[model samples]
Target: MLNKIKKQGFLNRISSLIIVQVIFVFAALFLIIFNYSTEGSVSKQINEVGKYQTISNEISGYLEDNISSLTTDNLRYEYIEGELASYDEILKAEILTTDKDNKLTPIFSYINSVQSVTNEIPQTYIESIAEHMISEFNKSNLKSQFAPIIYNTNNIINLLPLKNNQKTEAVLVIVSNHDFIISNRSELSYAIFLLFLIATLFSLLTVYLIFNRFKWPLNKLIYGFKKTARGELYELMEPEGDVELRALTSAFNEMSKTLWENSTQLKKSNDELEESNYLLSESRSYFKTLIEQSPDSIVVTNFSGNITFYNDKAGKLFGYKKDEIIEQHIDKFFTQPVMNTINNTDNELNGVELLAKTLDEELIPVYCIASSIEDDKSNDIAFLFIIRDISESKDFQEMMIRVDRYYTRGEMAGDIAHEINNYLAVLSGNLELMPLFMKKGQNEKIVSKLELMRKTVDNIARFANGLMDPNQDEAVFEEADINQLIENVLAFLKPQNRFDGVQINTDLSTDLPLVEFDISQLQQLIINLVYNSAEAMQQIEKEKVINIYTQPGNEGDGTVRVIICDNGPGVQSDKKEILFKKRFTTKRKGHGIGLVTCQKIIEVHSGDIGYEYDEGAKFFFDIPLKQKSKEKISEEEKASTVYGN
Candidate 1:
């Protein structure tokens, strides 16, 4: 072969080279087409497999529905059998159950057969389904579940786990003939193979004829290129071929002659373009990293409300990957109210509360603002939304309100009972002394106690009426003498509920001026604080004592100072900061709002309330002694508090 080629002319050698080149090119082409056709055949087989799986999915879904809605236990069995009959590909179907006695029972064709000893295959299939399906279903965050498919030679079988109304474990067995689907696809494969063969033969023939036409001209061009590679500038092609080849030869000669002239300019432009591309790629990567690492969840959406981009926080907030969430509707994460806010306006942002739904459909409270983005636009109007989770804030707010309500109710009950008991105490004490008064016909002590009791009853009626109508003001602020209010509270609460086992002692200063404060709130505040002290002391077996004191303005703010001292364990130093905070508890079952209520009531009356531990628990309050007019207090028909303690 080598001696014959050496003796051949340039045109003959070129013809032989063309034949060999055509064969190599056709061989590669044929190989590519053969691989493509093989892929197509495998794709058809995949479709066939999918068809069988689809029927199984349909049957499983039907069984699930029937199990949920059917009345009788056997109704679902009958319906499933009917569905199985319709699918010719499905060869047979049956239901299996594990009885309470660890026995396996086969329900064949709508009839439950005798219970048999535990069959390992059915239980194994159920466990396998549970093992694989649970993880796969959880990854998708989907509810529908099925076991991994069991493939046979020409058929498929699956034992799907199902639970009935009573949560009884059961398995549904389905057998399908996959060979039928494969047989239907075989004809398509043969036809594709035949077409492929015929096309390969025709393509090779056409390519051979086309190559013969360009063989001699291509040889001349190859010789010219070899000359140029060797730095032979005087070299040129004959330019005597076809129009296109002759034109290409002439252009090649001209390009070679001025190669160095334009090469520098071309290389400079190419270098700059490549550098610009590299810089642009780097900037894009930096921007993507910055977004992915952001703390706050940021989502960018197009005018059509599809997700264009989202940060890592956004993916975590939505329980999805960046790839999974892209092109998804923005409304999927937004609740109805948030949707209304964004869709209502054309281009406006309002910092509003919204609920975001995660992949598992859990709703989270979020504060988000959506505003239009001005950029290299691909849509009519794009939006950038910055979202922050506010679930903890909302939870804290709800807890505070609940604790406040509990303390408020306790205060109202305690104050009302204290006033009502004042009357009861007078009646019980005087009843024993009434025998002497009735025999002697004297009425000093009796008259004084009866008057005090009458006043207590009147106050109770006023308090009850105020509570009935919530809009009515319960406590009136006036120039209240501290000494007088202290005496009145003592008289009214002598037989208190929380102070039953406790002895109260008081030291009063008569020189203390009148302070502007609400009577009922002041009474409630004192009762709650005193009750708190008594309850704390109840745990100890000591003689419980509470001492009350009133003094002239002593805080340098011209405010009347009052103190309630108790012989009980004082609050811990570390825990004192939370004493005035709602929901902070120290006792085993305490609401921790009594001190908070005292703080609120003192603030309302323009006073300061605090706690300290010197000998024991010491509650102190300071109220301004500025006197105010009592015109409104006088106009009310309620009687002045008359008491003897």
Candidate 2:
């Protein structure tokens, strides 16, 4: 029990309370015992004094009664003296004596030295009383003689004088023992001490039991509180001992209940937070996957235009690997100093821009958007760029321009045909009349002139027939033999001396797969590129060669490649980026729509077109041999097939 209390830190407090209570009870008991002993002693003394007074009064009455029986003075004296003779026998006195006439005459001086109560009287008390009585008697003025008296062997003492007929006859004396006077007081004191000891023991036992009862509950309450502070769950304490402790236990139980509820709530909140974080991480991973797999070039950079991230498409489009571009400044990739233009002003360029060039000098028409991103700390961290390559869209626009030009030229050719037919008919009629009216010698000269006129008419008629055929239509896309297409295109452009002056070479692969394309558009594309190559090489004094090659590309997808290369002053590295842009021409007479139109036709057939300037200018385009089915058919394709059939 002691060890347990010490472990609980309650031993000191319990001991202190017990000690204090014990001290209080002991003090009260001590005071009660002291007061009882003192009061009893005083009371016993008063009772003893009352008993002695009563006995003394009784003795005086006896003397008075017996002395009255004497008729004369001598007889009274004689009677008193006779009474003193047996005073020790009557009163059990220790001493008795009688005197007469101031003389030391003992009428009845029975000292009874052997039977005297000298043991009962204190010697000092007897001596002092004897001296006092003797002095008083010596000074008395009574006619009787004075005498000293002591009784009970000096414990009690008194003096008496007897008289007869107005003369003092004799004096009587008695003494008491002091030992017998205080015997009762000693017994009373011993009894009081025993009672005090009993009371003190009872008080200590009661205090110990009460302190133990209170300490048990208080210690449990303290221990429970300490555990709660350490975040350990503890059971509610039950009521014990007194009413006050029970009430405190009830309140503590309620507090424990509230704490348990709060702990459960906190755990639930923590779980929810952890789940949300997990979901957020998954979402981020999904978004990253989408960005990496997209077909368009995507780049992310800091606010200062330093590249931070790029996807696979971005690497291919810019001809730079991801490792090369990452962490590089955007300015390193652009061939020209990108002008910051906004509202026709060159100053503000901090936002999104559309068209841009790449490190490989390829013109990438992009739909670019840029926005600033901030980190959790609210610091301006980076810029996010979403770029979509719009090169195919630009090519489509150029195709529309060519189609419009063709429509206009076809309309003008019809009017020219009608005018030319009328003039020819009139000229023919006049020629017939001249032949009938001419002499022989003049006939040959007129004939010669007539032949030249016939030749001019024939050429005009052929030109009109070519324009009036009305066979031109929108190019149709289908699988075609590439080698056959190339031969047909070369034959068509062979009429122009432009092809004859250029050293032309062909390396057509025999096993090249037939690719899906528009044959008419493909022919036009070849014509445009060959014409451009011939023009570029016209000024070069060296052997100017134009090489056209066809081969199966290494792309496992069975697509055929067509390559056109020229050994002329190759396209200027600086100008290569915008070469195919609409109206971007380097020549004075150049319309700038030729290469753009070629790019458009290739794209319409689900193919790609690109240029390179290593060693010499080279233009290549790849068309997939197999057609890919669209998920949905368009209204235009349906209408065209219906009309044509």
Candidate 3:
């Protein structure tokens, strides 16, 4: 049954058994060797200490025995008086001496002195005993030795006197060789060497047995793990070694099997994800291409109004290149007033908006939609702007508005003219009747009344004629000398009732070029400007003047400039840009269309009208010279022939 269980590979029975036996053998051998070695060393040290103590006690006993033989009260008095001088002879006769010429010969003299019965013993005996005592001292041998005593060397012994009262006592000394202690140490050292050899041999055997039992199984498991990590399920790991190690290996093998199975499924999922990403990228590219090829202007911007992308149409509309406009703020394209409104609104200007003017001063209206674009993380990354330029549409609408205004004004003027004319005709008819009905005496009052009525009718007819003249028809372009035109305009306005209190100054440049313009319209434009100047200067009490000038401009462009300036209050700073817009009047009773009509007339002639508000209001217009063509001359001749008829 045990063999069957071991073959089943559930646990590494042989490896566990070998490991346990190896550990038990190594530990038991190590402990036994260590205990024996320690005990031997301690026993050696104790034996050496005991030998030293015995040597010390034996030396003390020898000294006491010798000193007891020498000390006597009568002998001490004789030694002090230097009587019985042969101390060596007396010591030799009283005691057994080992060597007669030994280093302790002086100790015999001291003993002889203490043994004397006479009042004196010789100083030679005392000196000899003292010399022997010192020769036997332990320090005598140590003083001559440079190394500690080994088994071959003699153990040194020292004798020292114990003084009692005034008497000098003798001391004995002994010396023994340490050969016996050395022999015992050698035996103990041999035993320790043998035990160490056995332990080393046992440890090597145990390691060999354990390695032989487990090395094959561990290598197989490692190889299996590496193959599993590489996605190669080549083989299943076979359990080896103890039960715990077999269980661990089984778990690891199962985990690797599961991982290998999941890896295949994961690869399929990754393939799908990659395909989705590719399709998304392709879709983005297609949309981008479509936007780039679009004819209508398209721009994408951030919430801060910074343009992120723009199409070619956008570049043309804004008069900027794609690279130049991208990353630039949208506010950079707006005029000051519009920019202020946009900034104040926090870039959320809604409804169909118009830019009013492009970079090149061309009127461009844009209908735009602004929407926020967020990322997958739901973060507001940017804004998308889609715009359409409506300049042509706006121009058509403006034309329609102007035509409407004209028809409405014309109708009102016609009605007023008709009523005034009827009243004038009635007054004229009454004036004629008054002349017929009056007698000579009543004729004075009737004639005076008729004269007053005729004057009122004449004034009424003049007012109606002025009102009936169509200013729009007079704005047709014709070839005329600009200098003569300006002088005529000033002359016409100088005598007007409105100019009574305003001083006029004229400086017309000679040799001016001819321009194609409507003479009546130019005159009206000048009249309006002068009238505005007069009104502006109404508050001035002194030196209220209007200066009119004409000059040739640079570039030999055949250009003529008409300037009308006044020493009047200048245009308000904030209203300067809108001064020519329809219905944007600053006066209570004045229609703002006067300056707007002037601008329109100048625009139709392919000229420009501008103003400088610094140091009072200065209005100016410049017209380019118009060259006559052969076709125009032919048309003029045909008209002349018909008129001649």
TM-score of every prediction relative to native: 0.36, 0.43, 0.40
Model 2: lDDT equals: 0.61
Local accuracy of candidate 1 as per-residue lDDT tens digits, 1-645:
887445644445456656665665566566546555556645755664565456545545555574466765467656667666666655555666566673556665322122211222354664455444433444553333344254534555554555444343455565555433222336545655555565566566545544754667778778878877786655666765444566688888777657644666777988998999999999989988887777679998887778998898998788999889999888888776444566678665678777788897666668888887775764346888888877445243333333454454555577666665765676677677877877787788668767776776776654443332222233467776666666666655554566678899999887776678876667656766666777778877889998999887655778888899899888888888867653355568775656765666565565788889968899899877763345644443134433321
Residue 553 of model 3 has an lDDT of 63
Better-scoring candidate (lDDT), 1 or 2: 1
Cα lDDT, all candidates: 0.64, 0.61, 0.58
- TM-score, cand. 2: 0.43
Which candidate number maximizes TM-score? 2
lDDT of 1 at 24: 57
Off by over 4 Å in 2: 1-211, 226-234, 262-390, 393-473, 477-520, 531-565, 569-645
Ranking by TM-score: 2, 3, 1
TM-score, candidate 3, is: 0.40
lDDT of 2 by residue, 451-559 (tens): 7678767655544432312343445668778887776556434434455567778899998766777666676677677777888887888888889999987769677
The worst-scoring run of ten residues by lDDT in candidate 1 lies at 111-120
